[model samples]
Target: MISVPVSLVVVVPMCASLLIAVLGLTKYRCHWHISIVATFVSFIASLALLYNTLQIGRISYWLGGWEPPWGIEYVIDYYSGFVLVAITLVSLLTTVYAATYVKREVGESRDLSFAILNMLMVTGLHGIIVTGDLFNLYIFLEITSIAAYSLIGAGKKKGALVASFNYLILGTIGAIFVLIGVAYLYMITGTLNMADLRAILPVHYDSKVVFAAFAFITVGLAIKFALFPLHTWLLSAHSLAPAVVCSVLAASILKVTAYALIRVMFTVFEAGFTLEVIPATEILLVMSIIAIIVGGILTAAQTNLKRMLACSSLGQMGYIVLGVAIADQMAMTGSILHLLNHSLMKGGLFLIAGAIIHKVRIYDIADMKGVGRKMPLTMAAFTIIGLSMVGVPLTVGFVSKWHIAVGALKAGMWYIIPVIVASSLLTAFYFGRVIRNAYFASEGSDQGSSSKAHDHAHNQHGDRNSESRSEAPPGMVIPILIFAGLCIILGTAAFIPVSIAEKAAIMLLEGT
Candidate 1:
């Protein structure tokens, strides 16, 4: 099979950010155009990579003409390939959504800066997915985090600045912890290539230094993954930021951290060391349960729509982690599957919420009473995703829950069964509240059912006058429809895609 170069994937977006940054100095509008074209092209390229990876088993490309163990390499496995595709597609949709969401949330003058930050953010995500070196992972993780901090602050609110700073302080400490872990691994293993490190590390698993590296890596990633008690920074940072920022952060960054953590736990460390020798699975399992319960209860108390969704995401992510902690074949598949499902589900919902805020200026859930009437398309789209979140049949969310349930039974972790059920109900309660307030509640006493009868009477009389009604702008409507359609399409083909995930799981299991 012919080789596909991976540097192009990373370089394209980074170059675009540079061009946008340069154009930003000239005309802000020019920067937006440049950034959009760049990401769109990158998205298309990612699609090509996905197709190629599916056709070919795997793709490995080394940087600067050096071999894998000596130089940086980009390995395209099924899991990372899927991640690349999903990340770019969301970035593409959000770029389109951002044009509308950002214009309303931020000033036109800041558009270039927003575009630049977005390109760099995605570039880092791509790097994280492809890099075969541990140090490269750290570098890309920093890139993604720094860009995220700036993007959060780009909204220019005092809250935005403060939230960004809080994240910066906490995120920097996390990055340092991760670096310390990498250093410890290198001190003993003497190689930074992940594959090489994995092959050599198992022989010394009982060493105190190797165990310390494992501890440091786990704690550091917990900070990034927002694993329960470590998640204080994410809620506010995600809640107060602009819609586009929230969508990207919710959909990708945290998920990627989990992905990296899984990669390290299952691949870099031997199963004999991680699962059998140490109790990583048990610790992850307990913390995941806590994250699910706490996040769900907190979401029920939120009055702001975006903040509620942000909190709800914490819960959903916890479910993904639960699947990973369960450690059965089906459960691992479910966790990976949810990584895809959650990104699209939350991205679509957040965009719609942002649209609601953009058009109606309504943030409180109470104000959305009868607002659905004015925005049928947006509300209807919201209903589809909300039901999916509740694990309704024929949605992606149901597929994930099904797999997780089966995995739980297979492992005979009967105690976790109730926690899973309760968490599902909590999701239902909060999302059901949104639907109840939206479709069931009356608008107001003045705009009551009787006034609706009068309007119906006026309409029946063939009066030439009536209030105007229209859907959201095409930019917003189109992406919502695309994502909603994908929810169904992916759910329908869930088993087929899961084959790839199974292969990935098997590869990690067998340690080759």
Candidate 2:
């Protein structure tokens, strides 16, 4: 097994951010190059860490060579290690895709800032994954949130400024709640280390202070992850941000936030506290069901393609939360698997959306007639990914959904099965709209003709013939295709992620 510092994954990108900032002052225009290399290094380190964690049970690193409870700690078990891999892999691809897409959307003047903010955001996310100190986690969370706000606010889109402002207000409230929860826990336990908190909190599980802390933390994270009623800010932020930003936000940022919630519920506090002492599981179950239904209905109501995908993410978040509420090993495994699968699926979808917009300047679904012929390869990838989103069999989405369904049955919540079915139908209803419009809609129907579509394309790239292809640059298209391919490859080779997720679920349930 390889021996590497757990902090390596966080540090590399951080250093690169600093380097980019310095270079930006001197007119160096290779910020994307540095961002890609930093993310690649982080991805490699994450893989090594995952391999080591699987071979050895758990890994921990201490900052400043001090022991835990007295100094900061970074811990990686099955769960964090798996999450590290997912975040870094997607972040790496997003960086690659952004190299070309950012130029088209945000222009060259802001590329330096984009690269710097992107790296900083990545640094914060990696910090969140590895940190074992509650206060440190909160710190990392703020770093991530602030960087995200800047990235979104810097977008050239019409509503980008408004979207960023909404996200900032909501995101700050969530961060404050999390900070308060951390302070409350520290006041009681006198330790910021998560391991120590787990060891100490059980005796005070029935205390009102402990209950309040749990409530505060969970609600804050719910907002951060855009769960149901707290999700008002997600659609605008996701839909209006730059495509690369959308890809990272949908794929990595939200998943890690959900991971934090799971860690707090299952690791810091015992299962009994979450499931019985506080009725947390039951509450989550109700919220998740509502989110799944409402999110789907809203998704189908959207006219813009990016808005539709953003709405669908709300429903997808519901699936992950459902698995958590089930609180069974299989359910947890499904939740974790879906985290990885959804990252690949939604990330690719957003990239495709960006590609379409970049190539043809079409964002509204009604304007997408004959897009399939105009961008056949891109649309093909979209079709596969869209199908995966609908939980079609032999795709990664179906595997995770199947596990969640079985988990529901195993937990004797047979009613949840129908919720899953209903969500799937809703998913098909929405995604199928795009699929049909892209591939089967008559080119000369009332929507628009192939020639007219070319006229629309003319605005972007200047006078393309009806028969010409309008794929995004190779840098962007390659990553989108890679994400789509992984959806199928990982679906068929389900054992890879399942084995890791199964182990993580077991450890989480057993409180190891």
- State each model's CA lDDT, in order: 0.81, 0.91
Q: Per the 3 Å backbone cut-off, how many clashing residue pairs does candidate 2 have? A: 0
Clashing pairs in 2: none
lDDT of 2 at 440: 59
RMSD of each: 3.5, 3.6
Give the TM-score comparing model 1 with the true structure, all chains together.
Answer: 0.93
lDDT of 2 by residue, 243-314 (tens): 889999999889999999999998899887898888899999999999999999999899899999999999
For candidate 2, the per-residue lDDT at 459 reads: 38
Tens digits of lDDT, candidate 1, 1-512? 33447776688889989987777677444665666776777777766776777788677788998998999988777777777777778888888888766666788767777888888998898788888888999999999999999999975457988988999999989888989999999999899998899888878888989888888988998898788899899888987888888888988888888888887888788766888888888998988999999999999888889889989988888888899889888888888888888989998988888788877787878666655566778888888899888888889999988888889999998877788788889889888777755654445422322344554544433223222345668988888888888888888888766777777776666665
